[model samples]
Target chain A: MMKILVVDDEPDVRTLFEQRFRREIRSGALAFSFAYSGEEALGYLHEHHSEVVLILSDINMPGMSGLELLRRVRTEPAPPPPPRVMMITAYGDETSRTQALALGADDFLTKPVDFAALKEKLLALPSA
Target chain B: MSALYNFDLLVAGPLCMLIVLALRRFFNLAERLPRWNQALSWVWVPAVLGFGITAAFRYRSTLLDDAYMLWVYAVVVLTLLLLWNYRPARLALLALAPLLLHRLVRFGLDLGNLRLLAPYASLFKGWGNFANLWLIGLVLVARSQKRLLAKEQQQRQQEEQAHQLIATQNAELERLVAERSATLTQQAASLQQALEELQLTQNQLIQAEKMASLGELTAGIAHEIQNPLNFVNNFAEVSAELLEELAEEQAKPSPDTELELELLGDLTQNLQKITQHGQRAASIVRGMLEHSRASTGERSLTDLNALCDEYLRLAYHGLRAKDKAFNATLHTDLAPVLPLVEAVSQDLGRVLLNLLTNAFYAVRQRQQQGGEPGYAPTVQVRTRRVGDEVEVQVQDNGTGIAEAVRQKIFQPFFTTKPTGEGTGLGLSLAHDIIVQGHGGDLTVASQEGRGTTFTVRLPIYSPE
Candidate 1:
């Protein structure tokens, strides 16, 4: 199964992602793990470096931000075959998109996230 | 010659008394010439007595001549004494010198040749009459001189009185001018004080206008955030519906009990999140309503952390609502165990709003300048309890304020923003609200091209 890590400050994001990807999970095509902050997401990545193949992160959060988290995930020492990181923000501004792309974000999305389009993009990605 | 002598003896005593009385009455010499008055007093008494003696002893010519000569000698001696004592009348009294000389001559002739003098007795009598007429002329000259002296004395007194009046009037005029100038000075001071008060009132009015606009911006932000919150609610509801459908499928025969349990659990969690987000939206609406409401200037114990957090969100969203392209990383470090502070929450909220708005503006401006690459526009808000004070700090990693601008930042009507973009009373009003209204302190520290930090220190207890 393809493993994905979802990071957001809101605890409710876990439930939303679980419901949105319920069909794929039941079919044994995907598995999801959740972290509520950039720091927690980094910890998860360290523990399961090879298991997590994709990371979905919200850009705005207290403490460490998503952009910082992305920079660290890309630059910091880790196992070979790093996970693709996608950035999500409430403000869909060109500056944030450019900054995210410059910081090596694989994709950018605005909220209320287009889950259907997000699902199509995920399906199109080469499976692990 | 005898008849002429008799007429002279009868009239001379009375006429002398009459002349002295006229001088005293007409010239007011009794008051003007005191020594003359004293001498005249002695003369009038002797003349009257001499007249009495002459009238009583007219039959005895020898006795009559003795009385007349005694009186003449007394008059001459007193007149000479008056001329010595009273200098002003010396010239007038000198006219009587001839009378004294004539008396002495007659007396010498009587003593030398009484029978030989009988052949020229008429001539002698004529000379004696001329001497009497000269005495009369002397009296007229003395009267005229006395009148002139009296007029001169009156003119001198009048001039002196006029000078005194002028001096008094000048003193009164000077006093009036001094009094008027003092009043005018007092009025000018009061007017200056009034003008200062007017300027203060005008600054307060501009602050109120800024607050009103902030309230409107707050309402707009509430509406903007509300849209996304509504979407969240709708999406959560839809997810719950999908979960029900999954649960319905599991309810059929031979359903996977484990999957059914998980679907129900996710449905319950989704519904709970919907409720949580709805409450958050409700609180934001309430905060906006409170901001727009008229302030009652009431004080209460308020949670500083909550106030700061709410204003931070409002300011960020407000800016975002205006400029959708703006974005900044916000960091908050609120002390976990902070005490409630006694404060006017509405006024304090305005102060926080203003500070946050300024921080956001600074970051946005720096972002637009686009000089430094990899510059993440960042704003940090921190609250701490420092002994008796609660300190709030708003820091921005953006273009720092210049040293010159920082000095006058809190002054009213001092603006750095272009016209129509800022009212320039924001910092001034914030300073006033914190320092004057709540008896707190507001201070700033900045470095050009680096960053800026604004610190607000509020007392825990309200000042009485």
Candidate 2:
């Protein structure tokens, strides 16, 4: 199963992600972990870095920004391969997109994310 | 006998002419002397010549004696005329009067035929000569007196002219002083008007700054509204999908009852989320509208805790929108039971927002400086009910204000922010709203490099 970690300040993101991926989870094709902030996501990665194949994070949060998280995740020592990171932001401006890309973010998404498009992107990824 | 007559004619005629010349020259009476009076003075000359001729021929004619008596009458009339016309010649006229009197007395004696008084006639002749000498001395004295009188008149005229000149100068000086005073009064009036205009311009600038701050909040408000909108749309769309799935399960000839229940339950949850998020968006819009609306200056009961929370979040989000990387830990220690405060909500909200913004700004600035290792910027907002007063405190662990700057912080146009970033009216207007508008107090405590705290205290019951 593909394990995906979702990081967002809003608690409702967990419910939405879980509901959207119910079919994949029941079929034993996908599993998900949720974190409420950049700091929490980093803590989760420290313990289960090998299990998390991908991380999707909201850019604007209280403590640390998604771009900073992406930079730390890219630089910090981890197992053989680092988890791919995708940034989500309500602003979705060109500056943030370029900065996120420069900081080694694998993908960028805007708010009110299209689940179908996200599903297709997730399906296209190489399965573990 | 002829020698005495000739000697008398020479002495008397010359004496009368000399008296006339002295009156004309010394008293300046010639211009005023009448033609008849001048002719009378020349009559003496003819009389003297006639008497000399008669005596030379030894002619004892009565006509010559009568002519001598008429000459004496002419001398008396001329002296009277001089006295009447010129007041200064009165002394000279008095001397001439004695001589004329002496002549009249001698003629009277001769007319009366007093041969027994012939010795006395010699005595009368001696008296007449003394009278002539006395007239000469008096005339000389009169001329000197007239000279002194003319000098006194000239000195009086000079003094009067000088007095007139002084009066003219004094009037001119008074007029000049009045004119200068009028100009000064006009200048002062214009200065007062200019000061009023400046005050009006300052008020306009303050209003503009208020609108500008609202404009700055628009971005944060947009972000806030957008977040809930995203949630609403997503939930609605997900709910639709769940409804379709439930419809499909119901359409099956033999659908699984448990699966149908699960789909129905998810649909219910999605619908609830959609409603929740829609309400969230609505509340944010309402708050923004209230903030941007023009103040009506109306008072209402307000919940201080809720007001503080709302403003603190708005300020944080607003700063985050401007600087995406900025972040701070916000702690709220609001009283559980706070009495409603009677206040103009809009004005009070503005004051709270300004204080929170400043606290965030201070923390952000310290964060950027990166002065201390392992330093975490924190801002704490606390509200408490202290007896009859409600206190709201905004504290930040950031760069503290200096003592010199703190003293003038509430004065208008005093700012530490860079130009174009701040209008400098925020704190001053906040102070005014708290102290003047609401009859409250705003106080600040700070230590350099430590932190800053701004406290706002409002009476539970307004004194107004």
Candidate 3:
């Protein structure tokens, strides 16, 4: 089962994400973890480093935004290199996208989340 | 010592009066002049008249009683009259008093003695007491005219200087105005350039968002269409196998015709399922096409309740297809009797989809945050008639928005969602449609820990 870590400031947004993936979790197709802030997401990563295959993050947040988190994650000399990060934004601009892409984010998604495409992304995820 | 005079009462009195008047005009004009030129002329008038009397005394008439004295008096009075409007006239009049006294005494002492052999003794006697006083008045008039002339010259110079100063100030004011206009023009050009750059940036952002949404949609749309495609693929395989089986059975010989008829009927039923799948694929493609150009569409008398119900299910289904465990229980309190409004049906559906999905996400967020300890996640959608407008309210009892973020929550490119999860255009677009397009309003009221409610109002049948 692939473990996906989702980080955002909004709790309902994260919970709805879990509900979307509940069937996959029940069927043993994917595993899930959630964090409210970038700092918490990092803490989750420190413990569950081996299991996590992908990271989804929100860019605008209090105390260490998603871009900062992405940069920090990239800088660290850790095992299994780094999980493929996909930025999930409710608001997007060229500057944010350029910065995230430069920091090694694998993809970008705008909200009003399209689950079907996300499923394809999950299915297309490298050999985890 | 052979001088003789008889003072004529009329002439002497008039002569004194004229001198008094002359002195008065001189004094008045003295202060008013810049340098007193006209005042000096007053003194000359009296002196010239006195010389005429001296001439008369040397000729046939006496200096005292002759018309020459009267002529002298007349000249003095005329000078005074000429300068009557000047300021120094009072002092000149005071000087004329002593002259008047001398004239009075001479006239009284020598009256009726109209002889040329008038004694010089009387002349000297008559002049002695009043000569100094009368001469002082003469000197004042002279000095006054000099002073008056000088003042006029000084004032003329000052006027010329003032006029020059005013012209210089006008020039400076004009220069300042030109500089300000140029500065404003430069500022306007800079502002225009900035506006153009911003417009280009906005257009690019819109295009990028479209591409992103399209990418997101393709996966879900592919997944949705895949079911039908698979069904078509499977049916063709089954039919091909059936055709092979029938060929072998027919080659053996047709002993039981009823069995063949039953097989034929089953074949016809499979074709219907194939046709159904084809129809479903087309409908999804149509939904996607409708979503492509959201700004351009026709208005219709839309059933708001029905549109909301349908889009709400579609949005939920879209989310559920990706993660089945993302179980958000949706509760609806739709008004049974709702008003139909003139609006773009598809656009209204899009707005409903956006609001419902946001509510779903809000509820899901609460569950993730340990928001309510251990509780079931729920999203509530309610519609009602609020005044003349119909209100569609979507509420979620989730970890609600903070006060700080709530004010700008609906602004374009403002979102709490993860970078890829939202375009932030959803709420802003919804707001524009509800307010500008539909002549209504969209608003939200929320508490941090409790939940949030988004209310949308729609005008009923009122196109204007």
Across all candidates, what is each one's fraction of true contacts kept? 0.05, 0.41, 0.00
lDDT of 3 by residue, B169-260 (tens): 88888899999999999999999999999889877766565454444455456555655665556555555555565566677755456655
Interface RMSD of each: 4.5, 1.7, 15.3
Q: Which candidate is the best by TM-score?
A: 2
- Ten-residue stretch with the least lDDT total in model 3 chain B: B1-10
After superposing candidate 2 on the true structure, give the runs of residues whose Cα lies further than 4 Å from its correct spot: A18-30, B1-162, B254-294, B462-464
| lDDT per residue (tens digit) for residues B120-154 in model 2 | 86778788899989888987787778777778878
lDDT agreement of model 2 with the native:
0.81
Mark the regions of model 1 whose C-alpha exceeds 4 Å error after superposition: A1-11, A28-128, B1-206, B212-220, B239-243, B246-260, B292-295, B321-326, B364-370, B401-407, B461-464
Alpha carbon lDDT at A106, candidate 2: 93
Query: In model 3, which runs have C-alpha deviations exceeding 4 angstroms?
Result: A1-128, B1-147, B185-216, B246-262, B301-342, B370-397, B402-414, B417-424, B439-464
After superposition on all C-alphas, the RMSD of every candidate to the true structure, in Å, is 10.9, 5.4, 15.2
Task: List each candidate's DockQ score.
Answer: 0.10, 0.54, 0.03
**Cα lDDT, all candidates:** 0.77, 0.81, 0.68
Index of the highest-DockQ prediction: 2
**Cα lDDT for residue B131, candidate 3:** 69
Tens digit of per-residue lDDT, candidate 1, span B1-464: 35423444455566666766765675466676687677766554554465466456653344445456557555545644645555435644566566666666677766664433565877777777877787778767777876787788799889888988888898899899999999999999999999999989886776576665575466446644654495466557567667677868777988877766766776676777777777777767766666656667788998989989888888887776677557787899999998889888888888898888889889889989997878878899999999899999999988999999999999987889998777778889889989998999999999988889999999898468
